[model samples]
Target: MIGQGCLEQDDLSSSINIMECPNVISINMSASTSPISVSWEEPTAMTTDGKRIAIFNQSHSPGTSFPVNSNTIVTYVFDDISVCSFNIVINVKQVISSPDACECEPNFTFLNCPLNITSDQPAFCGTVPVNWTEPTVIDGCGGSSSVEKTHEPGSEFPAGVTTVTYTFTDSFGNQSICEFDVIVPVVAVEDDSVPPVVSNCPAHIYEVLEPSQTSLIITWDPPTARDDSGLPVSLHQTHSPGDQFTAGGYELVQYTFTDAAGNEAVCEFAVTVYPNGVNIDTQPPTVPPTVYCPAVSYTPPIITVYVENEATSADYNFTWPTGATDNDGVTPTVIASHQEGIQSFPIGFHRTAIFYYDTSGNRKDCYQNILVRRQGSAPTPATVINCPQNVYLEIPEGTSTRVCWEEPVVTDDAGNPIAATLWQRRLHSGAEFFINGNCNEQFVGNTFYDYYGNVIRCGFSVTIRAIGHENLPGQWTQWYNRDRPGGNCDCDTTPSTACSNGEEPIDVQCETLAGDDWLTVGLIPSAPEKRGQVAYCCPRIGFYCWNRWNALYGQQCLDYRVRFKCPLQ
Candidate 1:
């Protein structure tokens, strides 16, 4: 209005009469619903041409209440808007309308993310093995995704606890993880049981009747052992120190048997024998009778008896009479005695005085009669009693002394027979020393003058005059010296040499020792005195054998008898 009409600058010239048009309509885009199409109805009569006109403008805030662009207007076809936002204003003769509204919500779709894992698996016991399966995506979501698998206890899972994991990835690059468990089991086993046994003995073992028959030999084979079935067992043999069972002669022996299970048993055996029959006898050994003189009253000597293994069961005994005489009228006498059991006669001389034997086989005996004789009554002087050379005293001057002859023996020269006067005497020393006093058989001192006191010497001669009248008296015989005088003391005075101290060198040291030294030395170098003698009688008499003696003296003289009688010479 101000530009098209002629304008005059006048204030208030009737207010120019201009009425304001009504507000224009608008198309709005709501923030809650974006990317939408906006539309509105047209405004009224503001452009008088009466032609329908459409004007679009971006809205600037026309009022203080709404936010819009002031100078923008947009025009487009019905389908021209896409993904855009705006507040639009319309002017068509003052009215405009918004297009059909269209809104696009944010494009929406979900993507699934499965899980996956990677780790080692578990192990098993002993030699047991294991199986494993990888984890898989069991659950799924909206969008497509990839799943990856792995084992917790890797490759080999033992007979024990184990686990596996699965991981999934979505197209949106999201991921998830899951797991499962696995289990395993195992087991074991074994065996044992048994016993032992034995077998039969050997046939070689048996009894025997031999020299060593009292004992029996035994032999055997080793035994066998087995399980409850039958296996060989062990055997061992043992014996005692004196055990006779071994090949040698021992008293006892032992053997051992053992089983496979180490058990044991023992066995043993023995032997013995007895004795048999026998006999024995005993008798006195027989002794013989003996005679002394054959020409005179003769008699047999007595005898003795003996035995072995006899009825006495030992050396036999003889019950002899104390005064037993021989068949020859001779007295019996004991010589010697002894005892024998086994080798009685065989071991020594047979018992000449008896007989003997025992339960066993044994025996012995002897011979019988012997001869003896008696002396004659009358006897001639057989010998001169004193020495032919007379003896003298140490004194001289011819001291008076008696000279006499004795007839101690009264037997005949041959010891067989004699006359009534069996003894006689002779006077030879009477001429040397005169007889002063005389006894019936012996004369006293002889009378002689003594001129000097020194030793003297003398001798005399004698003759035998046989005076037997009967019994074949022998012719007169000359006298012979019987005994000589002189030596008296003759004995051994010696000692033994033995030392009690066990000392050495006995000859010197032992003799020099005190105490019994002298006696010991005497015994060391001297020998005992031994003496013996013999006697003979008439050969006509059975007693011609010699009668010996250890020592014979004047005190032990004896007489003999002649065998036949003879007239006086």
Candidate 2:
């Protein structure tokens, strides 16, 4: 067992040097009514170099009696650092006495029984080998030297739930069995490598909206698809023909065709909508990379560049990104703080900020930093001023991809450039490549090299994450009407007063009575909703702001619009 990165092994002669406390213990009693007395010797913690380490948090003594029916977990700490845990189980023994003579004990138990396993079907799709640690069994009175099981470890299990049963039989043929389920999803088994082909995808288009109309209806011939498997394919679209397109520029329409085997292909087109009466050049032209942050959501990202040779400067080409399309046609103008070209960079720190503008005059900007380092310049360790912002991608788990990003920039005392070195992977870092999961803070070691080959070490933390499957959008339900203007606003909000709508005392059910979702009501910001007031307004969607004339001290009420955020469509 390992805690964080420290290993806790049980073997006395193990090569790991540091041996933890007792392993899992299972004691069986021969008599049914007698409780078993269990005992174990505490092991000494040792270092790899034949040194001794002090242990702390030693809660249990050398031995004790097992509880009648409850389970007892034992824990040990090594050097007040690593944690080790094991379970102690006592089996209830049932003696089968016979007139003929020797009889077998009917009690048979396993140590740390494996739990049910749930796993997605492997890419192989066929029967795959499923394995688990075969549990050790304890036999008290019967000499059960051998064991039998219906399905052994490493046995191939078909897709779906398969029960693996293990049986233990004693010398006198008394038997006991334990079973666990292994489930593999069946949908993923129907796999295909070939994606369907989409035809008649529309090209980019430009249009002028009618002077009187606020929007335009766009239409196109539906794209067709074919699968190499000669099977029908399902088509999903972001927008369909005759969908209303507002005056927003560069609206995207996409359709995806998926074959029966789960392979998919997409067809996409963009349409630029221009407002009324204009010259022949009214159609928007190809604009420069239109960035979408710094103004709206933009924060210039700091980029770090390392100079390889011990020189005053180095020549490096910058990488440009594909900016997002703007609602209004993007302007052709692109601004940069520093002139960009393949030029020599001096041994110092330099920053560049790029600004992008749309036709609407909304500005977005990004930032980059150039750090040129030389041998004789002062050496500085890496500092995380701005790490690369992470994004979610619709990529499958366990998939590997080559990723490149800007490294954070740092400077020395003289304000000269310095770059971090890829020193070493931590013991708990990713194996081979990063897997699909949420971002987590991981410590990384960095080593800096001076002109004389001396090393300067520094440690810092960074979050690493992977893109997950495509997320589905949430849908909201239309507001429901139960309460109206005549309803008692104060009584509705107050727990003591059963809200009366003048007709009868009935509290407004916030979806719970038919429940599942939370029902909300609108609130007029001007009028504060609070107690001590005669009647506060409780306005909600599908219902009007209501106030009971004499409800609660005659407090004034405000209007609000509330709706339910739907969990189900």
RMSD of each: 74.8, 28.8
**Backbone clash count for every predicted candidate, in the order shown:** 122, 18
Candidate 2 lDDT over residue span 329-382, tens digit each: 454345565555676655444445565444433335555555555544344443
Model 2 stretches with alpha carbons more than 4 Å out: 1-20, 23-91, 97-128, 131-151, 156-165, 171-562, 565-569
How big is the positional error of residue 237 in model 2, measured in Å on the Cα after superposition? 48
In TM-score terms, candidate 2 sits at: 0.25
The TM-score values for the models, in the order shown, are 0.13, 0.25
lDDT of 2 at 33: 45
Cα lDDT tens digits for candidate 1, 163-232 = 4545555443333333344433211101101222223422212233345444344444433322221112
Clashes of 1: 122
Candidate 1, position 224, lDDT: 33
